[model samples]
Target: MASWAEVEADAPEFAAAVRRLLDAHRHKTLATLRRDGSPRISGTEAQFRDGELWFGGMWLSRKALDLRRDPRFALHSASVDPDDDDPAAWPGDAKLSGRVEEITDPARVSEVNKDAPPGPSHLFRADITEVVLTKVGSPADHLLIQWWREGKGLRVFKRT
Candidate 1:
């Protein structure tokens, strides 16, 4: 697994595109594994701070519990509908998969919650395994799919 900083260092351009997609929206869809191994999708907010991607949930929330039991997770950037006739206008979408490292330090948690509502929370830092971005290519039917995995750098695969 790699930190967001590692991706940026290894592939600046790809990382920049990913940052754009992720920063374009405030909320993302996070998929976690349930006890039976089924996928559970939950709405989540992510923040890039101190050179890391951080996220959290209200204390004891189902999603938080799921992460505690199974740290692996996939986070999808919020997407917007594109202009069908002009694929180039599409804002594109991104996905990040990794294991989460729960933050339990009181000082760290307090720092993270400084602007949050008054309530207990569960905070975590992401250790990314893969990052992917899919965008409409020149042809309306084609997609420019780019992905980066630890030690693999950036790769592209197009499909119609």
Candidate 2:
């Protein structure tokens, strides 16, 4: 697993591209495992802060509870339909998969979220296991995928 900073250090261009796609929108989809081993999809917001990827959940919200029980998660950036006339211009979408460690230290939480309300909440930092960015090819005839895995480093491939 690696921190966001570590990924950037290893692959600056790839990390920057992924960050751009992720930051282009506000809302994202998060997938977490339910107690029954089923999957739960929830709306979420995430951030790249202080060399780490961070996210939060409401006080004891289902998503929060799910993470507390099982740290594994997949976060997907919001996407818009590609223009039929110019699919090549699409900015594409990014997906991050990792395990999260709950941050329970009051001081650390305050530092990350200065505007944190006076109530219970959950703050998590990601230990990234994989990062993927998918988009249309320049000519719009194929798909481009750039990915980074914890041990495999970076890989780029195309699908026709």
**TM-score leader:** 2
lDDT of 1 by residue, 34-98 (tens): 99999999999998887789999989998999999999999999999998678788979999999
TM-score for each predicted model, relative to the true structure: 0.96, 0.97
lDDT by residue for model 2 (14-133), tens = 999999988988899999999998999999989999899999998899999999999999999999999999999999999999999999998999899776678878999999999999
For residue 103, give model 2's deviation from the true position in Å: 0.3
For model 1 the local lDDT of residue 140 reads: 69
Clashes of each: 0, 0
TM-score of 1: 0.96
lDDT of each: 0.92, 0.93
User: Which structure among the candidates has the greatest lDDT?
Assistant: 2
Give the TM-score (vs. native) of candidate 2. 0.97
